[model samples]
Target: MTEYNTVLAPVLSAFWDQPNSWTLETYLKNGGYEGLKKAFAQKPEDLIQTIKDSGLRGRGGAGFPTGMKWGFLPPADGGPRYLVVNADESEPGTCKDIPLMMAAPQFLVEGVIITSYAIGSNHAFIYLRGEVVHVYRRLLRAVEEAYAAGYLGKNIQGTGFDLDVTVHAGAGAYICGEETALLDSLEGRRGQPRLKPPFPATAGLYARPTVVNNVESVASVPQIINRGADWFTSMGTERSSGNGLFSLSGHVTRPGQYEAPL
Candidate 1:
């Protein structure tokens, strides 16, 4: 059997075992939200370029390059664009987001702030799987802590950028895992996938340009920003750089989450 230590690169899970690990203080002590600060220093377009250079990809099964996705959003029209996090971890073999949220939600919240700024969104939404009420509660508390720390509201960190994060519980429909269907469900409408031709990048939630990202995908932005793209690119393969959370379940000695470079 292979040693777990040799296979792991625990950036996202680095502080999961600390006492009161979810608190903003613990996060701050361990270098939390540093990415957002770095992100604020760059132009939104430049931020996107940095992520592009990092070679990070979506972990939500799509495996699409994240930077390219954000780049797809049209030039800002000064309207209400959004950064919707697809926290619906319903698909089989897809279980990293929930554990990440349960253990280190600050990563996601901070990532959301950075991503929203990069994509020119002042409003962001986390469409979480409703069944996991405990994780949902953790996320809410994390958001509140971020707000208290001046990371989510008006003039975050004195950067003059404002953002509001809303955590919405899904209706437990598997189809809602689809981006457009999730958007429809988010808008209080019947959950059904919307047609293409106007992709989410162009006409997403509220018919405005929106970027839908998975929890792990957004959770990665901070480390990339704080550590630099070259550092992120140093892990994983040439095509698929960075670490990923692999969920282990059933028939295993220690069934849980494992972070490995991919």
Candidate 2:
């Protein structure tokens, strides 16, 4: 017989079981905006460098390094550079993102703010699948609460950093989960993946430099900023770092979302 050591890490799922866990009040009580505050104290480039150092990868299937993707955007060309979050979780047996939104939307919202600030983006969007109307509504309300708390609008937290978040529900196409396809759908066009070379980073939404991240990927940003890179790198393997949500479904005795080190 062999014995294995197992540990559960609940960074994102820590408060899912709590009352009104989706509400801003609950999130604030649990040290929510601390990361945004910490982010404001540093330069945008430094924030990017911190993420690069943290070894955080995309949670949207590709596992690409998140910091490197953000760094791919060409030095600000004076035009608008956008940050679009791919919240359309349409892959088979994928149940992590929707649950995260339903339970702890503030995690995603706060992360969006930090990421937008880090990339010098004033406008960001959350592209959700239309099938999840309930989740869409939850996200809209979350954004509303964030705005009322002065976290989403101009001059956020009196730091002279401004951001606007728009939650757009897609037409429920599975193909839209692809980054470029999600971008096209976001532009009011039919969903389809675009050819590479001119990737989203250089020529993305509205043909400008953009950073497209997954729901879980963006949601994880706040914690990395709050806890520091070394803390994130401490978990998971040498190639893959930090904690991730594992979706367990289909005939399992204990089928549920599990958050643990990768």
Candidate 3:
């Protein structure tokens, strides 16, 4: 067997706690943001390096390297930039983010903060799939709770980092799942894909440089940051280890967002 399979598969599963472990209280009790605490104590560059070492790949239907993707940004060039969490997973049979948001939206919230801080973005957007009004409402409530708890706002956790997070809804379009199409829909335009190369990392949302990451992708940030990169990376395959939100749908005896190793 490959070494990744031996170490990664069991490591992530070992953390599997009760079903409600998604809740903020539950997550905290289980030593969740202990990583966040540690991350905030370290230099941002070191945190990024830990992720690169851990090998956390993107799970938004595309297995891109999370760290390398963050590295693609230009240094706070004074132009506005954004970290857009794509929660609009309209892909046929894929179902995870909505439920995760419903059960433990703060996971994504704290992740948004850590991600924004890492990339030097002050504002982050959680773009929801418009059809799920109920889910959106749940997210709104969760964001409110997080804000009230000091997770989202100026002076996050006394780190002197000011950040704001907004959860926006889309008009319900499959095309909107495409990076550029999502941006267009976010801007109130008809949904459609745009040219590539100069992708979202360079020119996105309002023509300002943006980092368009999937909901699960952004949510995974806090864990990678808080835990040593080696600890987070010690799961999955050599290329794609670390826990992933597999929005399992259809056929399976239990169709749900199963957090599994890649």
* Candidate closest to the true structure, highest lDDT: 2
- Candidate 3 residue lDDT tens string, 130-194: 89998898789777877787877989889998888888899888888888898998888998999
Report the Cα lDDT for residue 240, model 1.
97
Could you estimate the TM-score for every candidate?
0.97, 0.97, 0.88
Cα RMSD of all models vs. native, in order, equals 1.3, 2.1, 3.7
Residue 235 Cα positional deviation in candidate 2, in Å, after optimal superposition: 0.6
Off by over 4 Å in 3: 1-23
Which lDDT tens digits does candidate 2 get at residues 159-258? 9988999999999898999889999999999989999979988999999999999999999999999999999999999899999999989998778999
Let me know the TM-score candidate 2 reaches against the reference structure.
Answer: 0.97
For lDDT, candidate 1 versus 3, the one ahead is 1
Candidate 3 clashing pairs, residues 3+ apart or interchain: 8-235, 8-236, 35-226, 236-241
Which ten contiguous residues of candidate 2 have the minimum total lDDT?
Answer: 1-10
